[model samples]
Structures are given as structure tokens and as C-alpha cells.
Target: MFKAFVKIAVLLSLTASMAFGYQAIRLNVSEGTYKERNDAFNGILEVDLEDAGFTPKDIHPKIEYYYKLFYGTKLLKDGKPNPQFKTDYVGNLDNLGFITISNEEWMRELLMKEPKLGSFAPLNYLIYKKKSEDKTYVGTLTPQAMLDIAEIKDAGVRAAFTEKIDALSDATDEGMGGEVEYVEIDKLPAKTLIEWEIPFDRGEDVLDAKFDFMEKFEKAFEAEEYIIAGKRDFAEYWVDNDLENDKYDAYWVYSLCHFTFSYTVFNVWEHPELGASAPCSMYMYLDKDSSTLKVGMPSVDNWAVFGKITDPKRLQFIKDMDSKIKEIMTSLGAKEI
Candidate 1:
């Protein structure tokens, strides 16, 4: 009892909350090299996950986009780096990578209930190692944290979502045998998301219109040097499975990342775990018979509270990103609501 008390006291003393006094990232540390722990995490998932599309990219050169996310086609860059602003910046970490994972069947059930979950449909399995420390870290934003950011309150949705998240967490712990730590916080900022809507009349076939819209969406962001990191189509999944869901005409989400912006925050800074919140998931959906296409994403301003990033320069960058994203959305005809 005394030992547990001492550990809690020491842990609390050693830990500091990020921006909003809550730690959404859950860290699982193991005593091994990056390769060993990474292998372990993968090994455990092989049997459990429906399909693990392991898109892992190594970062060291202050980096480039491993792949640009395309809307319709899975084919983006040929798994090659997309060039962005060149910097002499060298990564201080040895191994830094992001792998998104999810249970597809479980996720499909919850999407109609809480489409906002797309903001974290595929949670980031962030892994990193420091050049100075001989340790490996694996983590993701906690299920509760994702719920908070997405503002989902359905009890059924919460239960199912957390069940899936806990399973993955257990697998991670089982594979990487080490200390499980948390970046703890009590709550997030009052406004956790930035959102907008683009109104349109779906003439005859909405499918063709969606395709055209996506092409413009992809090109516009790419022209601005934003990497479309990942994408998922929830409505398509239901169609394949023949699952009857009447909630929406279409639902999909995109993970966006600015190469230079990420390089500055993760590689140049001490907190690679921030990647858990990353490759920011922006969701677009149109309800059944609804003409307004709704778009929403977690606000980067929340990073101030979530990341506990106090540096003057870094704070400005996060603020600028919030502005930049809103600008891009509005430019694409999305009116901020």
C-alpha cells in the first residue's frame, strides 16, 4: 500500500499536464530497441485486427510526406516522399513513425451513431525513440480523449468505442512489456473542434458530384503543400457489407498534415507523442436527403492545452495552423459555422 502511494506521488510529481489539464496520450514504454518493441506491437495485432494496413514511415531528415492521400483512388505518391519546404533541421529522435489502426467491423457499427468519431476513426499508433535514450514508446490518444474531442455523448457509442480501444491498448501492453504511463489531464478546452458546411444541390446522381468535389478538394490542399495523410469511407464499407444504415447519404474522413508544420512540432520538439492527435482527421458527411455537406475537425488551438506547448514560437505555429486550415476550408467554399 505504501509502495503504491509512493509511486503515485512520484508519478504525479514528475508529470505535467499539457494545454487543457488533461493527458489524452497513453504511453506504453518497453525496455528494448525500437525494432524489438515495434515488432511486438505488430505481432500482437496480427491475430486481433480485422486488417492492419501498416503504413509506417521512418522520419529523420526532418522529413517528407510518406504518401499523399487521394480521395477516390488509393494510389497517391508511389510511397515516395512529397517535397515540401527544405530545412537543415535534423531529427533529434532515432525512430519516429505513425501507424493508424482500427477494428473495421466495430467501427462501422458506431459510425452512424457518432460520425464525429471519424475525427479519430483510425487512432494513431504513434511510436518513437530518442537518440539519447535507449527506450521505446508506443501510444495513442485515449478513447475518452477522442470522445471528448469529437464531443460524442451516446452511451452505446462510448461503450463500444472504448471496448475496441481497450483491446488495442491491451495488445500493445502485451507486446511491449514495460511501464504504462499517461500524460494526464482533467479536461480539454471549451471549443475542441472547428467546423463548417458547404451547401449544394445534389442534382440527379450525387455520386458523380461527390467525385468531382473530391478532385477539387485534393488538388486545392496539395497545391498548398498539405499532405493528405490518410482517408476512410464509412458509407462504402456499409455498402460492401450490405449493412443497412439510413443515417447518411455519404460519410468519409481525411487525415491532413502539413509536412513543415509536423516537422517543426514533433521532430524539433521533445514530444513526439503529440502525433497521437495528428495527421489531423477532417470529416465530411451529408445526412440522408440533406443538401448541406458538413465538415468538421479537431481544432489545433486545443493543442495549446493538450500539448502543453509553452514555447512562444511553437504556440504561434499552432495558432497559425488553425488560421491556415480555416482559410483553406473557406477557400474551398466551406463557411465556418
Candidate 2:
């Protein structure tokens, strides 16, 4: 009986430790116009990252991705049918800044330990103005949170990821002098690896299937009333540029959106900042060793906790989206592993 009690206690402690699974790196820029501030923030990301020994691989793509989202959502809100939305709101609202940077090669190697970690790779950041506020806020989901939620158990890998994010945070605050807020969530669901696996040697069109699956996945979401905000084929770009190494062969991140759901949680709730998690990411990569294509994504549950979304409708939208992703993966012959 005592042994059983001790085991229960240990399990409870473990659960408690994982409750707060994320930290939000925040900065406030209050001096400039929304567009000026947004543009300055974009410059900040590039300068700060370069100063911190990191190189941002792409900026325009990320910015365009968000613009697509902003405009697509504007159309979705206009109640237009036939799968077309208005694009007239492009420059009407406050400008948004977005960018992506790849971690050091060593950090990428550490990712091999747990393929799911790729979801956090080419780390993305966003800077936006809230409707109720004058200051433009800059933030990113920290690497520590991604590692924790993905259940990364290697102490070394965990430390490395944390160090990388901490360094990025410091660089971001270089000249801003703003108090960076780290919102530690204390009630996150346990670490979850949302991945699917297929049976077969990878040589068999798993690569082709990756592309096909992405197409089907977008169509499926559209059929179910979702929008394809944007997508990045990281692996294709990497391989094309001869950036590929022996570690892995392919990778991609797809951004999806439900504007109606976002309207309630972001606009109605006055949590425009929550759009930081907008265009939710679904990433996939190949595991050369296992000869299996690994599909993984950080669940929407992270957004709920990190964004502090509590309304039933918002939460339900998250759950439904998660379920829908799984269903699409299954349809592609990849069973959740």
C-alpha cells in the first residue's frame, strides 16, 4: 500500500510540474504609429537576432503569410460565400509584423532526438497592435514551452532549447528597454506528441505523400469550414538551397485559420494579442533512421492555455480543430502513433 501511495504521489508531482508549460516573451513599443511600430519591430527582429548570433532566413514570406490571413479573415467576416473573401482590408487595419529564423546547427541536431520538436523550428514571432491599446506588442511562443509540451525528456536537449530562446529574448530587448513579460501557465495538459506514422520503407513516396497529404489536409479543412492562411515548405527550400544534411530529408509547416472562431476569441474577447498564435502551425518531417515519415504539430490546446482562452466556444473550436487534423492524417494512411 505504501509503495502504491508513493507511486501516486510521484505521478501527481509530475502532473503538477507540467501544468505551466509555456512562457510568453513580450515587448511593448509605444512611440510610433502602428505601421511605423510594426515595421520597426520587424527591423528589431532582424537586428536583434543577427546580434545574438542568429540569422533570420525569411521575412517577406512570413509577412505575406499574415497579410494573407488578415485579408482572408476580412472576407470570411464579410459573409461572402463561394470560397472567396474580400481583400480590400489589406492596409486599413494596423500593420502586423512577422518573421522566422532557424536555430543554430547544433540546435537543429538536438531536434533529432525528438522529431516533434520541428514544430518549433524556424521559430516564428509576431508583433501586432491590439484594438484597445496604443502600444504594439511583440511576442513568440518560447522554445521551453514547445519542448515541455512536446514531452522532450532529454535534459541536454531541453537545456539547449531553453538557452536558445533565452538568448533570443535578451537580444529582442536590446534597445527597447521594455519589461519582457513571461506568462507562465500553470494548468496545461500533460505533454502530448501529436504525430502520425505510416508503415513502409520511406523510399516509397512518403515524400510524395507528404505533399499529397498537405493538399488533402487543406481541402479537408476547407470542406469543414476552415481557411488555409498560408504554408511554408521548409524542406523544399532547404534542399533546393543545398541546406540539407544527413539528419533529415523533408519538412513543412501549414497555417490554418477559422476566422469566425478567431473573431470571438480575439476581437470579441479583446485579446487581439492571441492572434500571435494565429495561422496555427502543423509541421511534418522525415525521420531517416526509422524510415518513417513523422507528422507532428503543437496542439491548439497550447494556444488556449497560453492565450488564456476560456470561453466554451473558443475551447470547443480548439478541440474540434485538433480532432479534424487527426482525422485528416488518418485519411492519409498515417495512424496516430
Candidate 3:
């Protein structure tokens, strides 16, 4: 009787071990082996989620989730996982970064829990199996993405403008031998998301003068002499040139507010030399669409010189050219229109 009992006990133990050790192969892939080519190839294998002891509820939410595993003798260029061993998640499992388990610990746990299954020593690989499906689509943080976020936070343009304003204040005090009284306006019309304004002096008078000039200028340029393109809010006008020596074949652009500002650029590539020339027969006017240019302390017309126009000779040349153009305009009876 004792001998028979021992045999029965051994058989039961073996059966139990076999049942617990039966693990389904979830994923398998062959990655890279080509030394000449930098690119690696991938293969994939998967098993049913239910067989892996997961429920439908767990797989429903994070369906788009993917995980990668590494394996084989080959390794990545960075000396990390072998680049050739790219494997996809099986059984609706989403990748959630790296698994916390070490290879030795994972193997030990599997063998102890399911002794019936054969040794997992042959399965040397990186496993990226999904644990749950209820996942959110939060974006990943790449280096570029982080830099972009940081740039937005820094608002470099705004900071630069603030520094300019501080310098201007210091200059005014030194030049005048007294602190000038000032009021800062935080808001202005027609400002872009990054644009702001503060009026320094006679805001009302400045605005009225510009608005009046724009009104008259718009009327003067309303003739049907130019071909208009684009919408009224933003448009371009093109005029063919007859002068042979003129580098430009056509003058194409849209002017706003009596040529005070241009929202859309005019492209005239023929005469690169004439690129900065004042309008010939052309004129621009401020319309309702250009309402953003409200009167504000004339925006320091010297801004380009103080801020960006680095070449002294080029700057003087521009001034000289402007004077010459004015003389030509006066001679031609072409008043500011």
C-alpha cells in the first residue's frame, strides 16, 4: 500500500508541474544581422490575450499601444539592445516603457511558479509585452519636443523687447538730465499673439495723424491701374515694367496704410538692386483690415538702425537714396499719396 501511494503522489506532482509550466509564446522576431547595411529587418509573433490570462476590459482602452523587445547576439550601434531584434507586443498588450524585472529574476519566478514548463534559458531576449490596455495617449518627450516647449516658455522676442525698453529709459534720463514722466499702455489694436505696445507720448495725436494719412492714401491708389490678387484684407498687386535697364520685370506686392507697413510681402526678383526703392507710381493706404497700426509714439522709425541695420555704409546709402527719391517725387508733383 505504501509503495502504491508513493507512485500516485509522484504522478500527481508531475501533472501539476506540467499544467502550471505551460506558457504560450507571445511574440518572436529576428532583427539585424547585416553588417554592411545599417538598416535592420523585423519579424513578429503573438499569442492570444485570453491565453495570457488577460481580460477584454484590460485590452480595450490601450489598443494603439506598442512595445518593442530586443534579443539575439547582435547589438545596437549604441551598444544597447541588438538593433536587429525588434519585436512587437502580442495579445493586445501596450508597451509601458521597460519592465522592472531583471532577466534572472524573471526566469526564476517563471520556473518556480510553473515548474512543469521546461527551462526558459534558451529565451534570451528583450520582452515588451503589454500589461494592460486602458492607457492614455499622452505624447512622448523627445529632445526636440522638450526644446520647443522650453522656447515657448522663454518667449525670447518679448524678453528682448523688454530689455530694449529699459535701455531707452536709461538713455532718456541721461540725455534730458531729468527722469521723464511716463505711462505704459499694456494693450493695443491689431496685435499678434507675440506683439504688444506701449505708447510713450501724444498717443491720440499720433494715431489720428496716421489714420488720416492712411485714409487719403487708400483713396489715391484706388485706380484700376494695378492687377489685384488675394483678398481685400490681404492682397498683392503686380505691375509690368517697360524699362529695359530695370532689373525687375514686374513689380508685385501689396501695400497697406499708405506704404507705412506691408503685411504681405511683394516679390520682385528681377532687380535685386531696386529691392529697397521707394514706391514708384505705387502707393498704399491703411484700410479697416490694417486697423492694427493704431497711433503709438511712431514706433521709433530708427528702430532698424538701432536694432538691426548693422552696416553704416549701407545705412547712409539708404538715407541718401531716400533723399534723392524725395527730390524726384517733388519734381514729378508726386506728393505723399
Candidate 4:
């Protein structure tokens, strides 16, 4: 009887999430593998979301390949191979990835009015499948929740952004089918985002100093063992695609991951579904004629809510990640704003 009650409660929570439209994470579960679904992902998403204006820029196409990485890490750490260290153990995920995507034209319209939107601009259009469940889940963080976390007070912006997310969600439904799901949390955590800005001289050439700063930024994070998994240049994207985006002189989105950190939670704890929020998105942008680079990303604290993560040690580790990111940004002369 208790088990039946628990099942009903879970169903009720998901129904509430679908009704309110703003749960911790939005998910669609389709039963099958990549090929069986005809490359529908989450549609391998070059066709659906892109056609609908959610264009992907940088993609970590296959994240489940990390088992090889784990093998190497284990070998190096232990100075010898242990029989228990299963080199072939790839965990429960059959497919997983982080695809950074954005609607450039919409962002072009909204960015100047709300740069904080960049935190989700090239949001993670995450896709993953668990072998144990024989199901694929594809979706992103909810836009309303995004607005709340970014503290966006503009009603018009909120409406438009959520509309955009809805359209993207619709595209996914066309590409993948099944019942939608959500993590049970209804309220956001106390903290939502980490944002900072650092001043830099544009100098004789805008690109020159920007490139130098980017190089330094990459190196600094690498020193702390964070993997720079992917990067996208929205400014160049507009130019190459012949889209009007003169608002920002330069703009970039970076995907960051601490390998050990991710491995511990997703692989060790066996919550592969959390791949939807893997690899943080850190956005850097400089407005036309401005001399500051603003950076922002959703806090790792949000991940705890996404996965309903309850372990105190794991929660603290997630919280510490937010602090570590802030410390790195500040060490690079960035000031929290």
C-alpha cells in the first residue's frame, strides 16, 4: 500500500509540474535507442530546434565516452590497475551529451535589455538515455525558472522568453515522443546564478585584447583542472549566417566541467538523467563600445534541485563548485555585480 501511495505521489508531482510549467528540469522520455528513434533526440537536433530558431553552436556530441577517461584517471591515480577497476564499465548511459544552443535573433533583440539572459542564451539542450530504463530523456531547464534565477523583472521579456522555450519544447515533442517528466522540486534554491564582470582595455584592436583575455581565462581555469569542453562565438555566428547582430562587438559562450566532480555525481551515484544539466554554461559578452566583459552562469546549486539531490555531502560539493567558480572569476580581476 505504501509503495502504491508513493507511485501516486510521484505521478501527482509530475502532473503538477506539467500544469505549472516550471519544475526544476523539463524532460521527455521516449522508449528506444538513438537509431530506433531515427536519430531523434532530442532529434540529434540539427533540424527541429534549429529550424525553430534554437540554433546549436557548440556540441559535446558524445559524453558517455567518459568511461575511457575514467579508466585513465584510475590507472594514473592508483599507479596500477586493480581488478575491481572495470576499464570497460561505461555505467548505465547508452547516449549522453551537452549541446549548447541559442536563438540568435531573439537574443539579439533581448540581450541589450537583459544581458543576464545570456546565462541561458546558449543553454544546455541536453540529451541522454539510460540503458537500465530503455528510455531517452531530452530537455533543458525551464525558462520561467531561468527568469526567476536570473532575477529578470521585465514581464515582457519573461513572456517572450518562455514562449521561445515553449516553441523549443514543441520541437522536441515532434522529434521525440513519450510522457513528460520533472524533478519533484517546486521552488528554486536560495541562490540561482553566479555573475561577474572584469574591465579590460579594447586597445588599438578590439579583437587583440579580447583574444588575450580569453587565452588567459582558459589557462586560469585549466590550472584549476576544469575542462573547457566547448565554446561558441555568437558574434561570428551572426556575421557568417548574415544575421543582424551589431549590438555586441564580441560575445562568447563556454562550457565548463570539472571531470572528477561530474564523474562523482553522475557516474558514481548513477543519476545519468542529470546529464541534462551537465557542463555549465559561462557566457562572456562585451557590448558595442563597452570595455567590460560580463560573465554569468546558473549556479551549481540549481543542479541539486534538478536531481532532487539529498545527500548532505553531495549538496555541499555542489555548493562549493559555485564558490570555486566565483573565486576563479575574482582571481582574474572580476568583480561580482
lDDT of 4 at 195: 80
Highest-scoring model, TM-score: 4
How do the residues 1-337 of candidate 2 rate in per-residue lDDT, one tens digit apiece?
A: 5434433543554465467443443443445566566655666665677766566654532343444465456445456552444444332225444455554354455756766666666566666565445666666766656677667888888887878775665555543434444455665566455877765355467677566656666777788778776566655765666664576666666666676565545544555555555556666776555666667777777777777767898788878878877776787678887
Residue pairs with backbone atoms closer than 3 Å in model 1 (clashes): 19-305, 19-308, 20-305, 21-185, 21-186, 22-185, 23-183, 23-184, 23-185, 69-228
Candidate 1 deviant stretches above 4 angstroms = 1-21, 48-88
lDDT of 1 by residue, 213-326 (tens): 888899989988898877777787787888887888888888788876776677666667787887788988889888999999999876677677778988898999999888
Q: Find the candidate with the highest lDDT and give its number.
A: 4
Per-residue lDDT for 151-261 in model 4, tens only? 788888888889888778777766776656775566788778888889978999998988999899999999998999778777777888898876788887788889767
Worst 10 residues of 4 by lDDT: 1-10
**Any residue pairs clashing in model 4, and if so which?**
none
Winner on lDDT (1 vs 3): 1
Clashing pairs in 2: 20-185
lDDT string for model 3 (61-118, tens) is: 1111311222223456577766535343123332211111012222222322322111
Deviation from native of the Cα of residue 280 in model 1, angstroms: 0.9
**By lDDT, highest first, what's the ranking?**
4, 1, 2, 3
Please identify model 2 stretches exceeding 4 Å from their true place: 1-32, 53-95, 104-106, 191-193, 200-251, 255-264, 289-291
The number of clashing residue pairs in each candidate reads: 10, 1, 15, 0
Per-candidate TM-scores read 0.83, 0.72, 0.16, 0.83
CA RMSD per model (angstroms): 6.5, 9.4, 33.1, 5.7
